[model samples]
Target: MAISLHWLIALLIFAGWGLGFYMHDLPLSPAKLRYYSWHKWMGVTTFILAFLRAGWLATHPAPRLPRVIPPWQTRTARITHFVLYLLMFLIPLSGWLMSSAKGVPTVYFGVLPLPDLIGKDKALGDFLVQVHKWLAFGLAALVGLHIAAAMKHHFMDRDGLMGRMVPFLKSPRL
Candidate 1:
């Protein structure tokens, strides 16, 4: 369940990020509006998935790192994971708040309408737009670091950490 949710959320985040960059420069039109709506829906879904993943984590604590892993590296990994989770929640939330401040209602998949969290305020909306953009870039950077660390463990360190998340792959030689 954890692995499935991890990949699903990862896929959604990448797709949403790609769409966000693509639509940013486009002139205001129906297509842009449609893209924004889809992006907003994706953000909402990502937020919910992040919440569910956190609940799962709370119940099922992650396995401990191998004793051979230096204590500092373990600490860094823990911190990185925590920040990643934090960004996962914050990115979408800022986007939602920004939309609310912009006086735009977020309709979930065109079915359910979510209420604005704050009253319309153009200045606040503009601020949140920057916040959301920066948070997303931070997330992208962290994800790159996370992947790099995983690959370093798998290929360079010959650790089985990657295989644990990817069951089909054989554990690397220790």
Candidate 2:
């Protein structure tokens, strides 16, 4: 069976989310230093997988929304999907910029040298950091809504919409 690009991208994004949270809560120490590398990896991984998933989606569009679902629900799903992709890319890009602005050299998995996109401007760095934080919060809320809606479809509506995205789930009729 072919691997689901969606699943791969989703997992990588989840890793980014986890690492972002951890790194946000810690000071820059050895213990915190450990999370930095992982955080960087997660960000890089998310960017890569998001690209791959976008390519896959371009080629293989998602299945149609449930016909029984309300029109507003369908619109919400579309908007949520748009927000997910937008923030998934934006969050990592902002993090990379914030790091660069702080004069933090980024290394991708300790091999390739990632470019420092921003100069050493303390003001710019602080601004980007705040932007990153707010964007992350927005993305987190969107993700929560998406997951809750999926759960609602699966349990309350007994629809197979969630199953399409969650590959491990059995179809409702099965």
Candidate 3:
């Protein structure tokens, strides 16, 4: 069976987001550590999957959008996609930097290790940590808007645009 890689990526993205969101303040109990463990694993998985997705995208570009989509909507989608890709690369990078600076090691799926992108630098690490936090917030906003737009196209416009991503959905014609 052909796996829905896009949906898989989306689910991982949301899962990672949830884990990342509360990690800062959560106590490091066994249960809480489990959350961080999942977060770390999910981050690594997302990084690898994103690399695969990018390779796939390079080889097979996305399909042309429906002509009925307004130019503004097209532009927004393009920009949002760009941001998502940026976050895909930057989030893990920043995390790696932050962890490395704090003398922490990153293990991928508890098997392989990832090299730190940069040597430990307290100032730079702190800056990257802040960047990572804000970028996540931006990602949350963009994701929300993207979902809303997809729903609008599906419901209000009765367009099949949303069905492109959500292949299971049956869009009604207006």
Task: Please tell me which predicted candidate would have the highest lDDT against the true structure.
Answer: 1
lDDT of 1 by residue, 22-111 (tens): 999999999999999999999999999999999999999888899989999999999999999999999999999999999999999999
- Score residue 10 of candidate 1 by CA lDDT: 94
| Candidate 3 ranges with C-alpha deviation above 4 Å | 1-3, 29-34
Which consecutive 10 residues in model 1 have the weakest lDDT in total? 165-174
How much RMSD separates candidate 1 from the native structure? 1.2
- Model 3, 56-146: lDDT tens digits are 8878788889899899989989988888878887787777778788666777776788787677788887888798788778878888988
Worst 10 residues of 2 by lDDT: 1-10
Off by over 4 Å in 2: 1-3, 171-174
Ranking by lDDT: 1, 2, 3
TM-score of 1: 0.97
Please give each candidate's TM-score: 0.97, 0.89, 0.88
* Model 2, span 1-174: residue lDDT tens: 114756676677677777778777787788787688778777877777777777777887877887999999999889998889888789889989988998887899888889999788888999998998899889889989988998889988888777776668864653
Worst 10 residues of 3 by lDDT: 1-10
True-vs-predicted CA distance for residue 21, candidate 3, Å: 2.6
Clashes of 1: 0
Q: How accurate is candidate 1 locally (lDDT)?
A: 0.95
